[model samples]
Target: MPQIFRIVPYSIYFWSNESDPLEPIHVHISEGRATSNATKIWITSTGKTVIKVLGENPG
Candidate 1:
């Protein structure tokens, strides 16, 4: 199961991490049960906040 970080009532964030390696500091956002790619992200502050669109990987 994946963990979810709530940013607000309408938006949620999740960190991107893999088993072997992880992606550059990035976050996944969603409106609800929908896909994260549908959500847009914005970065605020230096090396502090990062917002971006969430996407699914093909296996």
Candidate 2:
């Protein structure tokens, strides 16, 4: 996972596995490296972060 940046308690990142292709630009937000409990956000071309899905323990 490549970390893009961090904001307070949330650490944003994305996986670099080429085996599974991820369409469109998106990011995973989680506290620490707990990706399973993170939220998924889709990035729009207009520079907007849209919430795609909320994790089981989303903050």
Candidate 3:
């Protein structure tokens, strides 16, 4: 399981367990319920957007 950092109103923050699997390490961002619709991004190489959805419209 992943570890949560902070959860703001706009976004939810989480630590990556995929640093070894995917270099640069990353955090998970979710908007609504479930992490399915969340966007995964690289913490080191952010701003370019490398998001991968866990699912579709999990609202």
Maximum-lDDT candidate:
2
Question: TM-scores of the models, in the given order?
Answer: 0.36, 0.64, 0.40
TM-score of 1: 0.36
Output the lDDT of residue 59, model 2. Answer: 50
In order of TM-score, best first, we have 2, 3, 1
lDDT of 2 by residue, 1-59 (tens): 88899887878888765235555787788876646547778788999878865656545
Query: For candidate 3, what is the TM-score?
Result: 0.40
Error of 3 at 7 (Å): 8.9
Root-mean-square deviation of every model: 6.1, 2.9, 4.2
Screening candidate 1 with a backbone cut-off below 3 angstroms (N, C-alpha, C), the clashing residue pairs are none
lDDT of model number 2 = 0.73
lDDT of 1 by residue, 1-59 (tens): 14356544444454445335644544445555535354445445575665444465221
Q: RMSD of model 3, in Å?
A: 4.2
Candidate 3 has an lDDT of 0.55
Model 2: CA > 4 A from native? 18-21
lDDT of 2 at 21: 59
Give one clash count per candidate, in the order shown: 0, 0, 0
